[model samples]
Target chain A: MSSRLLSRAPQDTPGTWKSYLGLGVILLVSAFPVYWMFVIATSSDEAVMSSPPALIPGDQLMVNLREVFTMQDVFFTASLINSLIVSLAVTASTLFFCSLAGFAFAKLRFKGHNVLMFIVILTLTVPNQLGVVALFIVMGELGWNGTLLAVIAPGLVTAFGVFYMRQFIGHAIPDELVEAARIDGALTMRIYWTVVVPAIRPALAVLGLLTFVATWNDFQWPLITLNGTDYPTSMVALSDLASGNYVVYRRVLAGAFVATVPLVVLLLVGGRQLVRGIMEGALK
Target chain B: MALTDVRHARTEEPRHAPPKRQRFWLHRFDTKTFPYLMIAPFFLLFAVFGLFPLIFNAVVSLRHWHLIDKEKNGWVGLDNFTKLASDTDFWDALVNTFGIFVLSTVPQLLLALMIANLLNRKLRGATFWRIGILLPYVTPVAASSLVFAVFFSRDNGLANWFLSLVGFGQEQPLDWRAGTWSSWIAIAVMVNWKWIGYNALLYLSAMQAIPKDVYEAAAVDGAGPWRQLWQITVPMIQPVVLFTVILSTIGGLQLFTEPMLFDENPAQANGGYDHQWRTIAQLIYRVGWSDLNLGYAAAMSWALFLIILVVAGINALVTRRLGGGK
Candidate 1:
């Protein structure tokens, strides 16, 4: 037992130098495109068209960023703000609604909990592409097409979020504690506010971060609903820059880099939680 | 026991202050209705956006609901499906979808498995390595596709320059967007680049949960690391592998954004001049929005959903059998 304990240290593990080399290569391959994007973003227009392409960054990043903002056709700043609003709104509501439902499903013994949870699990398999046509029509009927409402409404609550929270709440919080709160005469809403919310904060942050990124990066639906609108999401605006007739690689990449930086930074901050969230969902 | 009694009495004072009758009513309401209210929003929103659209699609698919045609919104039962049966464009899209699915998913899963195996080993700066690989996954699809488009462009592309440096296809750099196989490869790179690290991390975490003594025992025996990975880690993480397989199948079949933006004119919804890599989702978007044939698009949507269900089922079945056989 003593030997086993001693052997469990990081220095005693069996990783070879070969593994480090392989991971180094993986890291390089993984990071190259984003690095290339920055390189292009900072390069002159002539450098973009150079025979080998620009392998190094220049001093033109500010110029290109300025160009992306002042470009005539795309509303870059407005779309960035639009993306922020839609992402935050969706993330907030998804966290609240999913957690509320998840708490009830986990702790509160209701008549139809099992059946409702089964429905939620089943809904996970239905691809979003299945109902795009009909959804477009429905949005049009509600006069929400070409508006952020059309983009935001369908994503207010997700089946996966509810399931994720339910699983987390079931496992993370003890039934005895909940029963103790009940015995102390704490009402359900009050208990959830004070007890459940605080305990499940890590899960909430993970879900919120993921939802924000997914909503921010959403391209297809927004393209379908808000393509021609003056106020588009950042993704839609990037697409506008990309698909233009006069293809300027520098401008397009600068816009893409700008759109991607916030997400990359968010991931850098909350990557461990994100990893925990994904693995927890898949393992059990 | 006296200490517990005193603490309980002190805590119970607040509840006793609310008269017994009111407390009883409050508890009943909390138990009965609060659960329903908590779960109501999900059901309500899903009905409006999710289930209703599905049923609505079934209804719309049977009618002639072209926005431009003079015979607008006519009930033409089964005609749209029959016409779709002979639609060459839909078949081409289907082939391209499966082609890219195979091309991307197979390599992505294998590479992810290998990377996860590498990451499973104890290493220095572990979080840095993890976040490094996962960086691509967070980049927006629109942005990544645009970046890759430049990378794989025929003229002045780093891909071609690298290929030239390696002395393969030295004379003629591949026009990645022009050729069918070339376009599929380019788009597959975009898809695989985004997903490989994410899937790797999932596999890595599952690997971490496995008992370390298992590997130690294998090493004590005659097993090499390669044999141990195949015989142990792969089998141990079979369920996670299955989960990822099903997920990739669904996401792969419904591939959009990458192929859509791969086209120079994304709004055109033409995957290419000859429709080289147009997925079913792109085709649906084109038919419904571009052509204004809501009925036909609805029919295609239903067909694509069924295809996804079938493909995912097959993938799950095959994954299970592979694990069992091994």
Candidate 2:
């Protein structure tokens, strides 16, 4: 047994070496673009456009930031405020509505309950892009053409959110507890507020994180609806900055980095829950 | 206990007035009402935003009208549909959309599966590795696509630098935003880079759920890792593979942001040079926003919607067959 154990150690070392080498390769490939973004962000326009590119950080980050801020009213402050307000409003509304619907679907018995659930699930198959043109007209008609409401209104009740919450509530809350509250003559809203809310706290946290990240990172609809006239999301502003003819590489990179930071931080904080939520939502 | 008591009283004391009275009060009272009330906001919001807009879109698609002249939106029975059927530009956009979808999605899923398999092995700092893989997916689309646009630029681009090293340098940096195939390749790379990790993570999660004993038994039977993977892992995760494939197809058909951003140059508004990269979504945007042909844009949207539904349906059927399940 001792001889076998000694032999295994020699064999295992090469395998371990290979595994570490593979891991190193993956880490480099995955991180290089992000590293490159920062490197460019700090470099001057000339350094960025230089022949071999600046592999290291340069001294123009602050200057580039100043340019980005002064170049447009859309970038540094207004867009940031717009993004924050839209994301916060959307997240809060989604949480309130989705949890309520989720609770009903999970625990409540009502007329057309099964049918309603099926319809909700069916909507998942319809891509929101399909309704873009008509929705644009609707927005125009409603006088929400350049407002943040145009961006936030359509995304308020995500079908995925409802589905996710229902699954979470089904497993996390018990019917017996709710029934007990009901027997004591608690109002329907009272039981939900006092009992069900406490039980599903973790699910709410997960949903909130997911919803916030999604709203924060959303691009296409905002691109269409908010056209950078009155207020634009961070993404739309960044797109305009990059797409313009007077290409200042450092400022563009700076904008990109700023846009990416919030999402990276959020993902780091909620990575595990996010992964578990996605897996549960997809597989189940 | 209370529910059971209420049920017992209702059944046993139907003829007795006192028990009936108590049971009636119990039956009418409960907290279920609250759950329903709490849940109403989602339905209310969905009715206004989700369902109404969808129904309204379908209605608008059938009418002949411009946004500026709403009074002219008279009911035109299937005229929009018929016009789309005969429009060559519509067909071209449809072809371009599917072309790019196939070019990107096929290789993306294949590469993702391979990467997920590699990552599934026992490795050091597995959490770090997993997060690194997902970095691209999490990067904001606008920002990453901008980076890609710069990378694919004609002059002094990194892609050309590497290509020249590999002996493909004789041609001018391939005019990525210009020709049909070049623009498609650029779009495909952006789509693949952004999504491959997402699909990989999904595949990895499914793979982890697979039992270890099956792989152990295969190894005991003198099977190599590749053979075990092919025989055991692939079959076990076939359902997930189908799911991603269908999801990717739906996503691919929509193909808006990359093409829109990549073709942002005013000169290339008709897609790249000769309208090579113009997709259905771009066409819809161009008609509605740029040209102010809202009626034509609505028509195009309906046409694209039908195409998406059909493609998704076909994808579902094919995957189900390949998955070998009822």
Candidate-wise lDDT, in order = 0.89, 0.76
What's the DockQ for every one of the candidates? 0.59, 0.38
The parts of candidate 1 lying over 4 Å away from their true place are: A1-12, B1-8, B11-19, B216-221
Worst 10 residues of 1 chain B by lDDT: B7-16
Across A118-139, the per-residue lDDT of candidate 2 in tens digits comes to 9888878877777777788778
Q: Deviation in angstroms for A234 in model 1?
A: 0.6
How far in Å is the alpha carbon of B285 misplaced in model 1?
Answer: 0.8
- Extract clashing residue pairs from model 1: none
| Model 2 residue B23 distance off true place after TM-score fit, in angstroms | 14
lDDT of 2 by residue, B1-326 (tens): 57556453333423434565775675565433444566566677667666676778777777776756667778897888888889888888888998999999999998888777777776656666677777776777777777777777777666777787788855665667777888899999889888887788788888888876556555545655566566677778888988898899888987877887675453224676577888888888887777766667877877777787788788878877765667
Q: What lDDT is obtained when candidate 2 is compared to the true structure?
A: 0.76
Taking the tens digit of each residue's C-alpha lDDT, what string does model 1 give over B164-282? 99897778878899999999999999999999999998898788887877766665455656676787788888989999999999999999999998898887899999998999999
CA shift of B182, model 1, Å: 0.8
* DockQ, prediction 1: 0.59
State which candidate has the highest TM-score.
1
